[model samples]
Target: MKAPQGVTLVDHPLVQHKLTRLRDRNTSTKTFRELVREIATLLCYEVTRDLALTQREVETPLEVTTAPEIAGKKLVFASILRAGEGMLEGMLNLVPSARVAHVGLYRDPQTRAAVEYYFKVSESLAERQVIVIDPMLATGVSARAALERLKEAGARDLRFVCILAAPEGIEALRGDHPDVPIWCAGIDRGLDDHGYIVPGLGDAGDRLYGTR
Candidate 1:
């Protein structure tokens, strides 16, 4: 019914429709990629609703008018490595000028924990609102690790966006970063034994890249 604290389930009709295709086991790679991108754009709209705006006078052929524009520093779309990149194209479509950062963390099979290998972020993260994205929030190991890295790099304002999430993952993230909000198309049953989201679309990176 309701998502837990600091979690937002994006229930937009179009978002839900795309999410259905994403959850289909038989969905093709090309289609899955498209759906992920589309859903990211839709989620972006909702997560950015409260972004500060400033009014500026605009000149028109008929008359001058005031228009609202995004205020302050441009946003940073910090992608959590491979799968996170899948959601980038669509987010960029909405914020064409937003800077991008890539945070790479691979899961240790035995430990089932995140291990960072690469991290690169834009400067002045404290001044910008960073939106970290991944197709799914499964174990939240990567999401948690990614946000920790971003914060270390000075990202004070941040948001996490995903297509699907597990309740365990949401709680894990909330437990660590209570102030950072999360937005996802839906939350599935839960994480499976190996830390994968049950009924999830299965390894988003693989599906997006047709790797497995």
Candidate 2:
């Protein structure tokens, strides 16, 4: 399926290969966690490709030269609760200095509506880029809620990153926040009756933590 506007598919060979393994039901929990970290790191690289840079003078043993450095305040990675935590470590591996924010939200099984339990983020969100990381974008309910909260808290620049997405979720997110770009490895056919991505890698949090 064609990706919706404002959405980017990170289909690099390395990412696809890892994703194939991640989808295998026989894969062990340890291996699943490793792949999530590896894929998240790669996805992070793509998401931040357009970050602004400024020139800085650097001195070498033999000579001095101007070098490019990331400009402005450090970026922020907002993890959307328990499942989002799976992507947090890998992203941090790439941007060690980035600030972190957490939005604790869960989907009610019956209604698939997002419920917030906790929320915390770094100050001055308006001055920094905020990327919300969650492994799965099934219903988009939780994601929308998280983004709304972040915006209410002063975030102006925001992006959403997920390992897998359903077309419905993409539409839902774009319907409300067209400006925020979505970066993902793949978009599956559609969601199941229970709001899970069809042919997805399964419950990412459960697979990562060996929990049901």
Candidate 3:
């Protein structure tokens, strides 16, 4: 399927391999959690590929030279609660100095609407780039709500990253926030009746924590 205009599919071989294992029903919680982290790290590399850089003078063993370094304020990772938290560690492993924001939102089983219970973020969100992380984008309700809240909180440059996504979810997000880019390991077929991505790695929050 053709990805939306602002969507980026990270189809790296390693990422695809890990995602396959992650989708296995027999995979244990421990292994599932590890794969999520590994994939998050790989996706992070793609999402931040265009981050601004500046030249800085550095002294090497042989001589002094100019080197490129990340410029401007540190980036922020906004995890959309429980499932999003599963991707946090791997993202942090890549950008240890990056700031973190948590937007606690849960989907109502019956309505599939998003309910926000918590929100906390670093200062000067407008001055930094924010990447919202969530493992699955099945309905896109929670993601859209989280992004809306972040925008109201002063986040200007924003992006969304996920391990898997549905076409419906991608379209919904782009329709609401066309300027914000999306990066994911893969885009699944579509959502099922209960608002779950078909053949999705089954409830990510459950598998990650052994809650199910």
Candidate 4:
């Protein structure tokens, strides 16, 4: 499916192929972890595609040359914890120098609302772009809460990245943070009765960690 404005569907052939394996219920923990990392790397490539670059003079073995280099402060990857960590290493592989911020939120069983327990971010977030990551955009409560907290901590330029998203979650996130662009590998059907992404990879955190 084509992504609407403010959202990017990373539909590259490689991402699609990996995503299929990722969705297979029979995929093992080791393989699932591997696929997540691989797809995360591919998704990171798309997210950083339009980064600003500055030309610099370089002296080659033969002659002087000009090379384009990424300019400005390092980027921030704010992982929404537990499942978000699955994608972190792959993103770090792409930008080893990028600063990492961890934001923790848990949903109340009864309320189904996000509760923030810990929040920490790098200095000068307003000066750098931030990419917030989570494996599933189920209810968007955690994502929305994280965005609010990030904004409060001075994140002006931000984007959201996920492996799968439900239509309800996407709408909720878009309504809350329209300025923050979203990138996802897949957008499945709407949320089910329990607010889980229907036809989605089951319980990403559990699948990633081999936890029930």
Candidate 5:
């Protein structure tokens, strides 16, 4: 099904291979972390395709030449806490110069509602491209809430990147943020009874942090 809004489910083979490893229950924590990093790296590659760039004239060893480079302005990474932290290193590896901010949210089990706990954004959010990172998009409530907070903090140009997502969550994001394109490695079938993605890598936070 075509997403009505700005959402992309990356179907690359390498992403699939890594996702498979991430799904296995027997995979060790170290391996899962490594795979998450690898997958995040691949996802970041696509997510930053439209990053702002500026042209600069550089003098080569022999002569001066005009070339394009990332503008003096840096990017801001807004990582949804806990699970999102796992992907931070991967994104940073790709864009080490980028600034990072952390947003903490937790779901209320009784109401299944998101509650914000922490937030810290860079000073100049409006000038930088913002990439919101989270490994799973089960319900998108947390992601949506985080995005709203960022926008309130003056973040405008934004993109969201995730390793795995459910159809419903993707739709929710699209419905709320049609202009902000979402990049996901895979879009899983549906959510389980408890709001987890079906056949999805179970509990990304637990898998990454062993804190179920």
Candidate 6:
């Protein structure tokens, strides 16, 4: 599959294998949760490849040497509510010092529009490389809105990461915010009439939490 505008899909066999397990209806909740974290760790590795590094000098028992280390400025892991929270653990494992924020929005059943219900972002958003997480991108409304909030809070550098996406959502996000880079594990076909992606793993929150 072609990479989405600024988005990248890991597409490795390990990622694909874990995703396959995630899609299986018979997978136990504990296993599914474990797989999600593992996949997120893999994705986080790619996502942070460009993280700014600084040179440092280290002294060994025998000699002194120069090395590179991550800059003191930490990245921000922002999630779009309940489902997005599932991807946070893996990111945190890679970036143990990173801060977290949550944005909550639910689709209005009648109009199929995203409605903001809650939000909380780090006070240092402007100085951090903000990574927004969501498991699925169906319509792009929620992602767009969440980004708008982040921008309003003074975040400048931003990127979005998702487990899956649809053409409609990619187009919508690109049209709305061309500068924001997007990264996804895969891009499925399109959204169904009700705004869910066809052939999607189904409602991510429902599956993750066994809420259904």
lDDT of 1 by residue, 115-167 (tens): 99999888999999999999888888999999999999999999999989999
Clashes by residue pair, model 1: none
The CA lDDT at 12 in model 1 is: 86
RMSD values for the candidates in order, in angstroms, are 0.8, 0.7, 0.7, 0.9, 1.4, 1.2
Candidate 2: list runs displaced more than 4 Å: none
Cα lDDT tens digits for candidate 6, 1-212: 68755778789999888888887888877787788788888888888888888999999899999989998688899989988888999899988999998999988889878899998988878889999999989999999999999999999999999888899999999889898888877888899988998787888888778787
lDDT for model 2, on a 0 to 1 scale? 0.95
Which scores better on lDDT, 2 or 5?
Answer: 2
Q: What is the TM-score of each candidate against the true structure?
A: 0.98, 0.99, 0.98, 0.98, 0.95, 0.96
Off by over 4 Å in 6: none
Question: Backbone collision count in every prediction?
Answer: 0, 0, 0, 0, 0, 1
lDDT of 4 by residue, 1-212 (tens): 55767889988999989989988999999999999999999999999999999999999999999999999999999999889999999999999999999999988879999998888899999999999999899899999999999999999999999999887788899999999889999999788878888788899999999997
Q: Per-residue lDDT of 38-122 in model 5, one digit per residue for the tens?
A: 9988888998877677998999999999999987588888999989999999999998989999999998888888899999999
lDDT of each: 0.92, 0.95, 0.95, 0.93, 0.89, 0.87
Report the alpha-carbon TM-score of model 3 versus the true structure: 0.98
Lowest lDDT 10-residue stretch of candidate 1? 1-10
* Consecutive 10-residue window with the lowest summed lDDT within model 4: 1-10
Cα deviation of 192 in candidate 3 (Å)? 1.1
Off by over 4 Å in 5: 1-4
The local lDDT score (0 to 100) that residue 168 gets in candidate 2 is: 92
Per-residue CA lDDT of model 3 for 35-97, tens digit only, reads 999999999999999999999999999999999999999999999998999999999999999
lDDT of 6: 0.87
